[model samples]
Target chain A: MIGDAFTLVLLDPMINFLVILNNIFFGSFGLALIAFTVIIRLITFPLTRRQLHQSRAMQTVQPRMAEINKKYSDPKRRQEEMMKLYREAGVNPLGCLGPMLLQFPILIALFYAIRQTLPESPEALEALSAHLYQWTYIQHAVPINEFFLGIDLKLAPNEASSYLSPAWLFVVLVGATTWLQTKTTVTTVTDERARAQQQMMAYMMPIMFAFFALSFPTGVSLYWTINSLIQIGFNIVTYGLPALKIEPLLKSPAPAMAPALAARSAQPQSVAQPAPEPRTPNGPGRSKRQNRRRRPE
Target chain B: MNNPRFFAVGLLLALFVVTSAACGKIRQPEGWASPAVSDSTAYFFADKDRFVAVDLDSAKAVADPKSTTGATLQPLLWQFPSNDQKDQDAYSFKAVYTQPVRDGDTFFMASYDGGLYRINAPDGRGERIATQADIKGKIVAGPAVAGEYLVFGTTEGHLYVVNKNNGQLPVGWGKTGKDLGKGIWAPPLVRNDTIIVATMAGEVRAFGLDGAEQWQKRFTASGAVADLALLGGDSIFVPTLDRKVYILDAATGAQKGKEFVAEDWVWSTPAFAGGVAYFGDFSGKVYALDITTMETKWKPYDAGHRVKATPVLIDGVLVLADRGPVVHFIDAANGTGLNAVPVVNAGTVRAGLTAAGGKAYIATTKGRLFVADPVKRSVVEVGVGGGK
Candidate 1:
């Protein structure tokens, strides 16, 4: 399906229009790609908006989930409690996941789309025929030249050709930005179990995105980097700023809610209750200081 | 944070990327070059310095200009620049040397290192007129002459038609300036007043003298056009690197039918003689194909790398030059090699062979120019057109 959309839509039209534009502009593939990318972005705007709302809703539910887990200590009952929690919050946990899941098909479509615009696929003509929109400009389209901003679209980074100069840069950008995007979303740690899961994801997600950025076309990396920056902007606007505002929001108009939080903290976490006092690397230094003061000063 | 207003931002980001890409304009083509034709006068880079002009009155096939065959023939007049050495260096950079447009007055030319040029008649007279385009790089093909214009394709994949009468300013064109998408190496065809050029990407487009494209045809199987032969009614037979010769309607750019010939490759320009198209291949076999049936009527082998030279048609007999030290005299009726004219030390014709003055002028890679008169069975070194 990815191959289908790419062939029919992305690579095919871009190749055709770029050639015509090259004919008109006299062979500038860079301008061609830039112009073509804009056309695609405009067409897919509605889907992108829907996806953003879903991500924001997903972020909102994480703390509520931690609340449900604490109230129902049994795993089976906790899952039921979490469902009840979701029902009360009027948000589908799946609603948060739904947009991400929806991206699978579009991602494949995008992957194929990028690959289609990319050269060296060996069976591109057949693929192009299947997926490319039959329109004008194809009458004179050829495989694009390799001089677009010094990146060879015809070459994939492998021992077959050689590593691209931009590959490392792209990998670094992907890893760094992915780390930032994930790091900025402050998942409230209501307990040890949730904190462990969050920490695992914090390290894992960036590494996964970094590996993906390495072998892709410089154009795709450009797109992803641009997309990531857009996501970052969205993160800042919605999740990023708001996540930081968590402390301030906690000082809500409702001090009544704060009494509940104080009551919850008052209850002992376990008989092994070494959990409170904000677990830290400083261990018992403060506790030892308190004991000294308790030594009848 | 719980307010869903955050999504308005992702939509905005998409809008930004799209808008920037959609709006930016493109830059212009780098440079342009015209083709050079080595004919009777060693004509090329017309306005520049030194060039060898052959004595056509001595090369008999062209001396008598009354014949239908000799109408296109003219003397190879050698021009020596006032500064011979520098002129020779300048001549080496020739970009275009078109066939003579008038009997003795004008022809088209350009230099790969220089620019476009339109020079005077024989006697090697006057300074060269230049074109606005800075001709650059390895100009492999073209400078095809049609009517009053010098038609040619560039390394930049553009086809240009410049005025031969006026200074070689680009008069009319099909492509805006470049990316006609594929470079054209084979010289374009001018038949019944229409100008035809083929692309490296198997596209055949025809245009009027003023640059209006008559039709455009893409050969699906002919990835690259190797040669084109005009067959009236806007139909042209094109031999392609794709191993097929496609017949296209020049007016509509529609494929009439494709004739599959060689199994490996066909590089030689197809010859139209006695209503048949003859071309040789990597296998060195010359196939005589019936244009109508798309079937091979005859096949003759030369056991060479390529039969790249166009077959010279004379009095219903077909003669072709090969990669050999030999010239082939093939029976037009059957694809049999009737005689072979050997070039004691041979190379792919270092330059195109011009048979005039009742002799075949052969230039080889070894830098030897031979004048062979078959009836006498003798070849003498008339001049060396190659560099020292």
Candidate 2:
């Protein structure tokens, strides 16, 4: 049932739209895929923008987060302080996830849609008729030209007749653009372990997707290459290229921190004096500390 | 470890892995080559790449091996590109779409990889007569055999006429092939010296044995013609994706009558018997049209699923299978349901039904062969050895 709903809602519409785009783009499926990627990016712009803003806000509160970690030795106390800090800064730590998770369905749907639109087999082509709408223009537009700039869009890089085919070029573009998109997006984390994980991901994701492109059709690779290129553009506009010292083209609202967070981080710590505690009623008292000391012995 | 960035990236990578695992396999063509029966044997693709010759007599016996009438089980006759020859690249045809056309003991078949083969049906030993380099396009439509000349069209829109004996292009047919400029998905209809070829671009043209245009007036449909049927010697039934089937005069390629409209795209080539045309549309409704009046013989029977396979007339009953894979039996005269409960639980039938020995032979995409008995209202899988 879920599969039926998915086809009804996403796959069918995408397949039809692709055929229409193929007609409008002079029967080139490659151009249609590129246009499709651009349209999908535009449709999801609001989610992407929100994710960028959340990342920026997370970056702005990094210093206060570090301070909280150092002051609270207890794990629970540190988590509480972190949550409080997050609330004060108006940042949802999980906000960046929503947009990324939402895009998975669209990406998978696009994969199936691309495969259906540019069928390589007779059976696949006949199957295409079922997914298509009843429009006369769309019906005539089929058996669309699978060749784009001398590369068969229906074949994968591994399936290419020669190693030097244009399919390999698409694979390279998918990897390169993905790496650039990842590198350009600035991610901030208070923990060293998290930063290390983030750095590893920046390299891993590109290599992984590039490997995937070897197994995927050239049309899908074209979609990915164009999608990553658009993402790189979005990154440059939203987060800027820090390594190249380029400021974001668009204004970000998160750089202006909340007053409560600013005041807490601005305080001076005395190395010679004992730290003050008992800020909240649930906070550990001296009796709890005594119990900890007695239990260890 | 608790950072949202790490969690998000990890989740995204995991989703990619799941998505890739879900749909990783490259879509390979599942051939729908229907069984081409000649005498006691049925020839078809037992699998996508393996073409086999099954002894119909043995298959029927095996289907009911314990019959009180002394039926005994037996193995298949032979399979082409045998297991021993699989390592040889020359034997690989990738996928076969065109049904094999029989000429005596030999059969001619075309593959999606553009290789044309002539196999001796008695032993299944095949020779690749033409390679992909020779054809230059995938063959979707089956070759039409007319005497010593064998003609076939490619998805590249070029039609080739070759000598059945030598596999070489016949004299005056050009060095390569005659380009029709549109992909030919429907098999060309050959009647004596004239070959009628319909294209995916909706052009219907008739050419002679020497590749000369035979029709003076060109006929074009609003949509791609999926299949063509010959109604007697004077008219041709062109079933198109435009949801209308046009009856054209065979000699001049002119409209002979009003086009028969259907609820959806008409892909099945209408089966004709006694001046009545029987066919189904993609919308699952099967209609019987009386060519004398160009009107419905009866109300269209709903099979409740898409129908792509051409219906066959067997013993006064029109037998056709829907994409639902459910077989339906309609009365050839009145279009009433013949079988109270239509034959169910069959494989998806995309190949056109072949009638032989008073039974309909069906070959599915998964390479399973079935024989349906109209008398018994039963569909039985013919278990060829090592099938699917």
Best by TM-score: 2
**Tens-place lDDT digits, model 2, residues A31-94:** 9988988888888888888888888888787776776655665678678877877887888888
Task: Compute the DockQ of candidate 1.
Answer: 0.04
> What C-alpha lDDT, on a 0 to 100 scale, does residue B147 get in candidate 1?
67
In order, the interface RMSDs are 13.0, 3.7
How good is the docking of model 1, by CAPRI class? incorrect
* Model 2 chain B: worst 10 consecutive residues (lDDT sum): B1-10
Our model 1 lands, by Cα RMSD against the true structure, at 15.3
TM-score for chain B considered on its own, for each of the candidates: 0.70, 0.88
lDDT of 2 by residue, B124-239 (tens): 88877852226757788768897787888888888888887777777668755888888888888898789999998888999988778998978998888868878898889998
**Regions more than 4 Å wrong, model 2:** A70-73, A187-195, A242-245, A255-259, A262-297, B1-27, B50-78, B81-94, B130-133, B171-176, B291-294, B340-346, B365-369, B373-388
- Tell me the TM-score of model 2: 0.86
Docking class of 2: acceptable
Chain A accuracy of model 1 expressed as TM-score? 0.63
